[model samples]
Target: MSKSFERFQRRKLISSYFSVTLSIALVLFLLGILGLLVLNTKKLADHFKEQIAISVFFKDTAKQVEIDELQKSLVMSEYTKSAVFVSKEEAAEQHSEEIGENFLEFLGYNPLKNSIDVNLNAAFVSTTQVDSIAAEIGKRSFVEEVSYDRPTISLLTENVRRIGLGILIASAVFTLIAVLLINSSIRLSIYSKRFIIKTMQMVGATKSFIRRPFIWTNIKLGVFGALLAIVALFGLLYYLDLNFPQLGVLQDLKMLAILFSGVFILGLLISLVSTYFATQRFLNLRTDDLYY
Candidate 1:
């Protein structure tokens, strides 16, 4: 009968430890996901910004040699990602395909001008930067006009700023919540062992001597929990990369390393701090208070 009771107590203690560790692991996994999004925000924004292009139309009187030279210059510019020259004939064909009619046939002439479509680097995709570049290009003698979607650029910039700010704020709030959750889990785990703690104190054990084992054990559990979270985080990232290759989810190894390291350190720090305080709480309690 004594052996049976001992077995039950041991099983209960193991179950409690497992529950606490699993809870910590789940919380850290969620925090890891938020960190990933924060790190990749700039990369995602740049990908979209690179898609919009500026079109520089040429005057009919402009010589082909001069037009080609201008396109070459634009391609070589620091601000340009790429530049493609489209002749009037090619533009007319593309327009006809789009509108499902050969407007050239109806008008008896092609109205499109030869132009260079310049895709700017993500850094220069803002409305002001684009306007400055376009103005400079419009001053060229061979250029008839420089045009792009100004409203789209402006709106994208504003939306990206707002979203980045929102994510940062959310990250801050989640971090605080994670700490509180981990601390609560540690406190609860310690609570179950309050009687053992008071007994050690009554047996003339020093507080530090009592705390060393509990602190060490909890820290080890924190490490295990952090490792579990990291494994899950990596698994999720791998799944995302495999299924959605275009998202390039795992492209930045350095950021991922930093994020994972942060999770491990956070786990260790929170565990150490919470364990110290929890043990201190029980240590300070009177023997009479222990019953309550």
Candidate 2:
């Protein structure tokens, strides 16, 4: 290549390198956020589930031993995550405090029954699973009644399901859009050097030899872009940690690792594939078509 030709090529390469990296980083950052939401959706759902506790009120005649056994049994059950026993006196005191009056004293005696507050596993938080679990638990001889707000559980499940579906659709659409934009941008960059590709081919350069440099350059750009995305994601997570401590705790390291890996792989794959096709297009084009 002449000194002028070499200079032009070098400038084009530098420009394309930075431009592509920024473009990729912007899209990947958005993708990282979406992936985080997708992962945390389950955590948020589980939090809502935890709020709908199963209150297992004991029968008036239930012996202390039988009540304790039932609490232990529920704690060991597949559905239960935790179970806290509330004595009749404690329940009465709690009710009195809520109303800012000694209702037990005014009523002449405590009326609240001993109960176990059970929290179910996230997997069993749905309406169907909860209903089944409640039915099974209610059958016990000591259980006077098993109660929870069915309407609240149903609302939470329905809202979460709908939101998850919407998010999934939006993520797929945005991912496709990002891929297309990256592809077009890469193609435009390569299009500037169609003549150079033709020159190499005419001078007996093998296709792989011609593609190697471009591929290597884009690979580096892809990695750098992915790193940028990770940094942005890290900042957002840090902010969440500072502001919303509870939600921040849902940021599992394993899930974050998977998301970062996904970003890197996505960036590398898109760059490599786009480079191959863009390079191949010029390799196959007729000399005169370089103008078009």
> Which candidate comes out best when scored by TM-score?
1
| CA-RMSD of model 1 | 1.7
Give the lDDT of residue 129 in candidate 1: 90
Candidate 1, residues 1-292, lDDT tens digits: the string is 9999999999988987898799889999999999999988998999899999999999999999999889888888999999999999999999999999999879998888999999999999998899999999999988889989999999999999999999999999999999899889888888889999999889999999999998998999899999999999999999999999988778878988898999999889988998999999999999888777
> Cα miss at 124, model 1 (Å)?
1.9
- Identify the candidate with maximal lDDT: 1
lDDT, candidates in the order shown? 0.92, 0.88
Error of 1 at 84 (Å): 1.8
Residue 58 of model 2 has an lDDT of 91
Off by over 4 Å in 1: none
Which regions of candidate 2 fall more than 4 Å away from where they truly are? Answer: 1-12, 249-251
lDDT for each residue of candidate 2 in 1-292, tens digit (9 for 90 to 100): 5999999978877887789899989988998898888887888888878777999999898999998888888888988889999999999888888999998777898778899999988888988998998999899887899999889899988999999999999989989988898888788888888888999999999999999998898888889999999899888888888899877643588888888898889999988998999999999999988887
Give model 2's TM-score versus the native structure.
Answer: 0.90
